[model samples]
Target: MAENASLLVELLTEELPPKALRQLGDAFAQGLVAELRAQGFASPDAPYTAYASPRRLAVLVKEVAAQAPDREIVVKGPSVKAGLDADGRPTPALLGFARKQGVAVEALERMQDGKHEVFAYRRSERGARLAEFLTGALEAALKRLPIPKMMRWGAGDAEFVRPVRGFVALHGEAVVPCSVLGLAAGRSTLGHRFLSTGPIELVRADDYEAVLEREGKVIASFERRLERIKQGLAAAAGDAQIAADEALYTEVTALVEWPAVYEGHFDAGFLEVPQECLMLTMRQNQKYFPLVGRDGRLLNRFLLVSNMQVDDPAEIVHGNERVLRARLSDAKFFYDQDRKQPLQSLVPQLAQVVYHNKLGSQLQRVERIEALASAIAGLLNADRSLAARAARLAKADLLTGMVGEFPELQGIMGQYYARHDGEPETVAAAIEAHYRPRFAGDALPGDAVGDSVALADKLDTLIGIWGIGLAPTGDKDPFALRRAALGVLRILVEHELPLDVVELLQAAHRQFPAGTLAEATVGEVHAFMLDRLRSYLRERGFKADEIEAVLAHQPTRIDDLVPRLEAVQRFRALPEADSLAAANKRIRNILKKAEVVERAPKAELMREAAEQALFDTLLSLGPQIENHMQDRRYTEALSTLAGARNAVDRFFDEVMVMTEDAAVRDNRLALLAALDRLMNRVADISRLAA
Candidate 1:
């Protein structure tokens, strides 16, 4: 097999945030592959490599075929009713279909599989060359690929993350000609914004790496950029260690066309503030990387990379320092001002800020949070006073100037203010930890008080939105309800807090119903909680049927649901579990047969040996099944059902269940019915994957 050729693409644009780069990179790669496959490109595999910087998004494909493979197509034509006339002559419909198919009218043939007459035809056509279709299709796909956010430049219609300044498209040495969003296809691409000289001509797809390298651009791969960023930051920090925030590093690497390391310092006095405040202010506000001493204490120094290289390093350092100074000053002012007032003082200010137009004010949300958290604390056996204190101040930061500018600092500032106000350590910790693991892979709440507050906050958000019918509709969950739901699951799972989620919902709803916030009722809120839980658990590696099964048990506590699900999943893995599932299905089938006559066998009249065996097995296993399920030994319960398999198969094999005597038939049916109840305690075996 000869090595397949490659195609290269580069969409040069203005600087983009590091966060947006991956999203755009993914969109382009996925869209290109999907389009090529759709256009019938079938020459081995065309794997893609993508690289992004602040200015350009680039991709290089490998092993793409020179041409598409010829494919056979089966086109379904008009039905016999529409294709045939009374005289059986080729009707206008048949002629029209042939014309639409690009086949001659005489080529039409009637295909028959069985009794039904159907109009079908098979045609083979030579596929268009890969280059030709790829060129056109790639151009079209690039224009339509969805970016999370886009901007219009040049003309109002020209919209992308940024202006489309240049495009590089090549298949082997040949330039694939097409245009998108006003940019014409070319082999020319701009390299690193400042480091590279000018627009460089990509002689061929294979030369992409060499050209960028020679031009002082690091475009071959992301590994090089990541290495340089990591090495440079570490070298600059020396004894002052620069710990990489995985997320922050990724965002910064994507935001720069050519990353150049720079370090700056703020007044040491700022270290007096909490590390969370300084880190948040630095990373969120200035996009500067933070540094720490060997002892893991916050160092007053910070490091950042500039996308552009400056002639004067000292000037660049001074400029960045100025920005840091202003930000740290503002942070200091907010911290000091917040300390002067007690945590209780901010409680009244929350009323002025509306949480949601329909959901009332933040004060009302705090009220809801307080009540729910207090109730949840009681359920979890936490200190109710601490839970209520934490909940009341959770949203107070929304009114803070610091949080207003940096919404990500909501909980961080609350914790700071709580501690500054000399609130109990538990309450302060809860304030900060309540929003733990705000997103996927985020940390779970650390303590009982924190867990309770976390649960209450997410529950309030979920129930409040659900009550108003403003629940996440499809993929449009603007409220991040999905995250809220996941947070609820994480808090429950990590804390292992035995909870009745429904009871919690009822408690929360009772405290903060539509009347409480002009929203809805407890019943409506409960339904929404169920929806959020379904979506949440499904995301956390639970199958839909597994969720349905465990949720059917409706364990009130998240702790109960987790183990029950773990048990169900454990049972699902066993060999006998499948056999038991098969038996249940067979039993249901037997019951179905008796359904039409509306009569079932009775055990009293079951004289057959197999029927007697099945009845005895069910009778013996009934209490064992109940005991295992009561102990939450779903796996054991499923194991117990394994006993019914041979007995069930034997009964089906020898006995005629639908007998003349309704009493005998119903009695046998009752035994099978008992088996279903036991098996279903583990899972609705009928819904298990076959």
Candidate 2:
């Protein structure tokens, strides 16, 4: 149990799903290493390396013990009162407890447990063997893999992402006997299915990668494979760019065990299609890295990540080119067929494509989007017809042959077709840009018309989806409503637009016919949108309580929120901020407890000098604060209100609001209520009080 040695484990299988192979490899390695550390077989500082190839998942861990050390355990039994019966003779509870611990009744000691004396048994439980614990760990790690679909092979009960081919577990040079997925563990593995020089018999734990690369013709490390691919791409592309994309690189790394880059080319006429379309075809469909010129346009050449490093790549290059030519031919066919009809002609066909059963067809959704975009354009002083036209044609491309083949090209193809239809440049740009900020950290639309349509389109989705109670729940957001909400907030707050989110929700939902979405949902949707805005503000580094203070006023204009928060922050730092905040809180409590009394304080009843002084200050500062607030200079307004701190403190110190005289008490209450309103004009600073 005290011995320690480096260990290696590998699960060699058929080719794994490339997109998720990296994630699966990491999860398996971390889960096993964590289990070993938790079971006391692995040191806290033990290092491990994860290896994922197209056919295998493996981990090499250092300093793993053969077994975990024994530990003491305390088992509690019945309380003393329950254990003793009559003359304190050994009762059934005491007898049974001693029998379970395999000790005499006299050996059971009594100890205080939770205010009661209870019998307890203490002993050392033997540590577990690594060979015994490893089977469970290996099974658990494989069971937890992120496999979208799992299948069983050869009528076996074992299930995995792919069919099991091999399972290798080694402790240094010794084989750790275990069974996984119907395969006995051993220090053996297969390399490249086609190019392996010979069978690999691993003699040592640390020689896995080296042996695989030498005799088995495979690079075992996922990272090493990525580096090899990157270096090979550089050499193959020369001075030209390889059109680098991380996702494409990762997938390619997962697809090959030994990478060798081969260059292929298609006819220059295929470049007539938009570069984005061509690039997507190569990257998404073929998994090829398209070469781009210095001007960022796709060239006729592409690079393939072939798994084999053959003596002659002439035949491989020809085969890749022949395959790519056919792919490009289909792409050109779709492009030519799509341009035959104007983009607008596709609008009538959308009526047949159901957007959602509850929301009717795509044509109906477009009508709602068109109206909302037009309204938004009016508020932004943009050309209304351009926004409307863009919204009308935005979804038309959904029916195009090009877009039907590649759904990702919906908006992009819309832009191209809009231009081909001789639409205004602004409208054409808007058609594509309306879906901007598609994901988190993505850019917002560049043009005014684009912004208008983007906001309107996202708002329509949020309002309709939220109105029908189909909003996101827990981890499930089938409609992506949360993303839609955040997009709406980013457009409003980040753009500094003064549009009221609540009003936009109302305007959007109203466009839907009766029973489509509840009219009563206006308030709920407003609160939800504000919550997204709150999260957005926190990400920008605003304090939580400060945001709460400003939001209490329900400010309609998001552009004014930051200035209001800054004004409250400035108010908190003032010399009188603490005293005024305390007095405001006290006034709020008093008003809550007091009965309905809307009457103003009588001037004749203000006899006390402290009360009179507070009133005079408020009367003088009233106009100044009002003027500053009107100009949206929130900081200046709150600064003017801070002048009342001295008077407010004095009044609280020298006067008591709950007096025996009824008339005087009402007057004091009225004065406090009036002061509270003026101080909170910008924000509810009372919430900021300590």
**Best lDDT goes to which candidate?**
2
C-alpha lDDT (0 to 100) for residue 147 of candidate 1:
66
lDDT of 1 at 636: 77
Positional deviation of residue 175's Cα in model 1 after best superposition, in angstroms: 6.2
lDDT of each: 0.76, 0.88
Residue-level lDDT of model 1, residues 1-690, one tens digit each, is 122477777777887666767777777777787676665553336577776666777777776666677788878777777788898777787888888888886677777747666676788878777645755676666776666677888644877877878888787887777666677788877776667778787777988877787775654455577678888898999988775577788787876656789888889999887777788878877778899898988898899888776777888888999988988888888877767777688889888888888888989988989988998889778899999999988887777777776787888888878887888999998998888877778888788889889999988887777766666777898888777777776677666777877677677677654364434445565565567778777877999888887777544566666677777788778766676666767777886776533333356677999988877787788899899878877677777777777877787789886788877767766766666666777667766647
RMSD in Å for candidate 1, one decimal? 5.2
In angstroms, how far off is 217's CA in candidate 2?
Answer: 3.2
Worst lDDT run of 10 residues, candidate 1, spans 595-604
Off-target runs (Cα >4 Å) in candidate 1 are 1-11, 16-18, 29-44, 47-51, 58-138, 148-160, 166-205, 216-223, 234-244, 293-296, 308-312, 513-549, 552-557, 566-579, 588-657, 662-689
